[model samples]
Target: MDSAFFSMIFRMKYITRWGLMRSSYPETLSEHSMDTAVLAHALACIGASRLDKPVDPMKAAVFALFHDAGEIITGDMPTPIKYHDPQITEAYKRIEAEANRTLFSMLPDDLKPYYEPVFHPAKEDEAYWQYVKAADKLSALIKCIEEEKSGNSEFKDAKAQLLSMLSSFDLPEVQVFMQEFLPAFSKTLDEQSRE
Candidate 1:
């Protein structure tokens, strides 16, 4: 039987993020996932190479790609409402978990074992998950930066909030990326090319 998995995953392009705010350029879930995956790979590399930590860059990238897969079913619940209180946060987590399970069920039985960890990360991969989380926040931070650079103040507060959240992460890899690469997001193409 043909699996609907890939087809359902492709619908990520139709799910726009930052739905509550006006954006100069709307970002799709696919775009966000790609951005997160790239960032996750970089962070993992930084950890393994520069920080001398054991991190599988490929795994991080793959995990990041599927990190928000459930959002397709949840319709991108706005963060404010999703995390307004402990009860709502707990409820949303349950809903998200169910959504992920539904997505997982779409895969062929033979492939289920391989994709299991992608949907529900193993406990041993906690360190890698931290990197994914940091990368996810970095993606949002980049989005906020882009929005502000586009003269949209709607994301200004979000940018600050993301900055604070990222700063709280003790991962030196995150700090390295923030310091070395993130600044380029604020520059013009010409300015970046000259540097």
Candidate 2:
């Protein structure tokens, strides 16, 4: 089989994030996925280590890595437009499902099983998927912070809105992460180095 299919997935690197906003720094889907994976891992670890939950950081990390793989085909839709209406959201989900299916088809039959679980997990993984969702929001929040750090006021409202959305989740792990790590994003590099 030709390796052309893999190239399509790698094209995620060219998809810019925050397409609707004036960003101080351009971010790519590939970059965001990696950040989300790391954040998901940390959130999962926090849940397991401190919250007495049996969360698997590695699983969460892997899930987060491909959480937006569908976006490679659909392009990164702005969150506001993506969630503004119930109908639109539902339609977009269907589009994403189709995209995932297309992505899965790219791999050889022998390798499909391994990739499927990453893009589409079993029902039992629903609980853990929450952590991936939370990490996605946290990653956005971090992006807001980064924009603010760049002296760009465009993200000020976004930062507040993201914080509100995250707070509404009220997940113990998210709360813990916000308390212990989120504040650090606001600090200077020197301050972080000292700590």
Candidate 3:
């Protein structure tokens, strides 16, 4: 009898196209998760040090790593398509919830309890959640930066909306990063940020 060994699966992506990190353009789920985890760690440390709000950097990183594990089933939905309206937003959430269910189900039903904490994170750990959300935003922002630098303004609107969303969120350290560090993102391309 074969056991359900947790091994990575190399499957073909059908409908979903485009992936993370333009440097490695058309990256994969595996690649995106790796970047998200590492970036989450760095952002958590920045938040703790500069904002005086300490976070469990390691746990936050883990959260980021698994944040899109659900995508293994649902596939990456482009932001424009995902957020076109409240109906679409709700539909996407439903898709995510189902993917989350599928991931835990991959474990022995009896052993699923152990993975719960990591998969369905607690909002009670506010700082960790903040890092997860910030890391998500940052990854998209980096993608946007790369697009703009490539002379493709396709992501310009997304960059602006994401920056606006980040602005209204009361995360002081993120706010500071946007003000000071973000401009450098564009200047690195020999151009100033459009916003």
Q: Write the per-residue lDDT of candidate 1 for residues 41-129, one digit (tens) a residue.
A: 99999999998897899999999999999988888988888889999999999999999999999999999998989888889989888
Which runs in model 1 stand beyond 4 Å of their true positions?
none
Query: Clashing residue pairs in candidate 2, if any?
Result: none
- Alpha-carbon runs more than 4 Å astray in model 3: 1-5, 8-24, 109-114, 179-184, 187-195
Clashes of each: 0, 0, 0
Choose the strongest candidate by lDDT: 1
Q: What tens-digit string does per-residue lDDT give for candidate 2 at 57-114? A: 9999989989999888999989889999999999999999999888888888888877
- lDDT (C-alpha) at residue 82 in model 1: 88
lDDT of each: 0.93, 0.89, 0.69
Better candidate number, 1 or 2, judged by TM-score: 1
RMSD of 1: 0.8
lDDT of 3 by residue, 38-96 (tens): 76787777777776775777888887877777776778887667778999999899889
Output the better candidate (1/3) by lDDT. 1
- Alpha-carbon TM-score of each model against the true structure: 0.98, 0.96, 0.77
Candidate 1 worst ten-residue window by lDDT: 74-83
lDDT for 120 in candidate 2 is 76
